[model samples]
Target: MSRTLLAPRSWPLAVKVPLVVAALMAALGVLASWLVLANLADIQERNLRRLADVTLGTLAASLAAPVERRDIWETFDALDRLTATDSGMPAVAMVVLLPGGEVLAASDPRRFPTLRRLDEPLLRAALRAGDMLFDTSRARAVATYRLEEGGEQLGTLLAELDIGALLAERRRATVALVVSNSFLTLVMAGVGYALVRRMLGPLSRLAVAAERLERGEDPGELLEPPQGSREFRKLFGRFRAMARAVQERETILKRLAEEDRLAQLGRLASAMAHEVNNPLAGLLTVVDTLRRRGEDDGVRRHAVELLERGLLGIRNVVGAMLVAYKEDREAPGLTRRAIDDLRYLVQHEVARKRLELVWTNRLPPVLPVDGGAVRQALLNLLLNACGASPVGGKVVFEAVAEDGVCRFLIADQGPGLPADMAAILERSGPPTTPPGRGLGLWTAATLWQRIGGTIRVERVPGKGTRIRLAVPVRVRAEVV
Candidate 1:
């Protein structure tokens, strides 16, 4: 069995397309923002490291002179001024630790919300250790570290660069991100929505055209186009071409099918006319003979029987052909009267040909379908089976419902199908040659899909070939 997933009829491309695009865009924006945040933090860390190296170098050189306490202050203050005043990026917030771990001088001491002096564990570790550079968060951003000392290892000295400026940088980056993203999102959304809406118009028009075609009108007759797009017009053009090709193929096939039907009807008509003409002539002769010389009861009786049999044959032939050919163009339906009637019709035909008829009562009376089309499909199958049979051949039709689906099985002892016919019917083109048959298996498949059914073909081991059709059931109570 085959399963088909259909899009909901009420779904609107206008709303759906924009929403999907927006979600995708938003995800991209978040990823970009995270990268920017990480990169900005890295740049800030590098700037502070450069400042620490410069401050520590000058302090190390000053260590050669005999220590002057006041000059120590002056040395620290001057160096801080130099870095603070000319920092390409606000590089000022820094603190200097003396030999005894005292806060000798500073740059913006208040920038630190909570200041623990040189006594702090991280600061003490940096000052006590010999000259070294490291990273520590005196603040929520990157801060540089190094020992403040002269080359001659005096008591360890430490200085740390401040990180308050990084917050300002973060704010700036945020503002830029918001402004840039807002502008770009609006521009992209406007362009994307327009593109989507334009693309959708062609599909909508195609649907309308399909409906018109189903009603037996030429869709291309009016040929008004949908709003076109820069990229999608080509797509729609291809779609239109494909639709036209399908319609053309369908038209040709339909003409061929109709011609075949007509030819079959003609054969039946000729047979009936011939049969009726002979019986009428015989009846006329018998009546004339009776009129001339008193009727022979036995001869009259025989003539009457022949006349009745011939008339009955003509009636039966006409009735079958008429039922098979009648078209049902309105809404598809399942009629109780038709199913019961065809079952009997098929039984008689099979009996007349001396073929065995095997049937199972698994088919529910209530199945959603076109009763007439179903009958025609079955009739075609039975006709093929009967014609293919040698005297005393067997044919079987069975139905079973399982897993919320109906399976139809038809088997016959007819000549096993040719490879060519199997390929077209089963569409599993074998590596060998295919058989040619006048009946249209492709049409049967098309009709099956139209009514939400499926067809599969396979060979029955010793019985010849088997055809399987899976159709969905429709209940009358549900329709009511």
Candidate 2:
């Protein structure tokens, strides 16, 4: 058993292509933005740290000879000059820490709550641990380095670096990205929609062709797309080729069926006509003898009755065989008669084969249908039915108007066939078993279909089989 769902694959290229492109553009946009952001942020921090390190060393250089207050002031004055030269950089505080947690000369001493206290985490770490450290807090990257003179550690240089430009730069970048992405999205939507539509338009044409085939109508030329992309041409080419192949095969089957039907008529034409002519000629002779002898009224009436019935039966046989020659190929002798009259044609043939006849012709037979075709189809079905039937079985013929079309049923007491065989007859395809190079029911079924009609079979279980044939009376002119 299959557990997965089976589905048809259709990309509807218009939708799939645009979505994939949009997703790719978004990914690339994010990736480029991330790279630029990371570099700008790192550069801001690195530049501020370099400036702090240089300023600290110069201030510490003044105290190289002796650690004194005046020396630190001299160092601080020089650091102020340096800060003026690079004024664009934010104001930074550089503090020197003593080993016992006391701060030396520092920038922005008024900003601190206590001048004697070193509260910076980096500064405290430098004083207590006497180790170099780096820490960041409140948009600042701070670092402390131990200042030494001649392999002897003097104090710790604590530096504060401001790097807020990273956020400002990223904000500007994001604005530019929004504008660029908006423009790209518009272009992708417009161009992508056209590209998808162009690629999928051929499939729409193919759908129309399929519809034509389904309604049994002639299909027009499909797209001949050598003017488009290579893949598109190849795909359309295959569709066109398949449509042509199907149409061609259908045409061949129709011709073969017509020929088979005509051929069968040719073989049976002599015997069938002879069968009707003999009874008809004998009845005519008896009527003439009755007239010449000046017989009583009852005797003349009896002979006339036989003559009328025989002539009616003969007219029906000829009517069914109107298309006996090529001259009658597209002609039909359609006339309305009592539907009960059609039943009489098969009644004799049925009784001769020891099969019961059934039908009362309940509806009016003023149907505008080709009576000849109906008679031909009915006669062929009864003959085939008799071959399958046993002695003293029932054969039924019925007529009615259902859903605005005239339908006829011809059933016989014969062995019912398999479902597959019934399907083949319905399709109008050549028999797989070929009906063995002789006259058979498929031949007649094909001929009936060519003129806007159809034959279908239904099983009657214990009784045997029923073949129902229907033709739209509105199409009578086309059939004729």
TM-score per model over all chains: 0.60, 0.58
Candidate 1: residue pairs that collide: 63-150, 148-157, 368-474, 419-434, 420-434, 420-435, 421-435
lDDT of each: 0.58, 0.63
Q: For residue 95, give model 2's deviation from the true position in Å.
A: 7.3
Off by over 4 Å in 1: 1-119, 128-162, 196-217, 221-245, 270-318, 326-354, 358-369, 397-409, 419-436, 440-452, 470-480
For model 2, how big is the CA root-mean-square deviation?
Answer: 7.8
Compute the lDDT of residue 188 as modeled in candidate 2. 84
What does candidate 2's lDDT look like per residue over 1-480, in tens digits? 133223313545677688677877778777877787678767766766675566666656765554434255654555456556664545467665555556655666664332387666655665565433334345555655667778877766666656455556768977887778767876887788788777678777777877886445666675555465787788777877887787786676656656766665665576466667678678878868787864688777877888788887777766545433334534444443434444444444565677777774544535656555665655567667766777898777777777867777877777785566566557764333244332456555654675577778888666788888877766554332
> In model 2, what lDDT does residue 402 have?
73
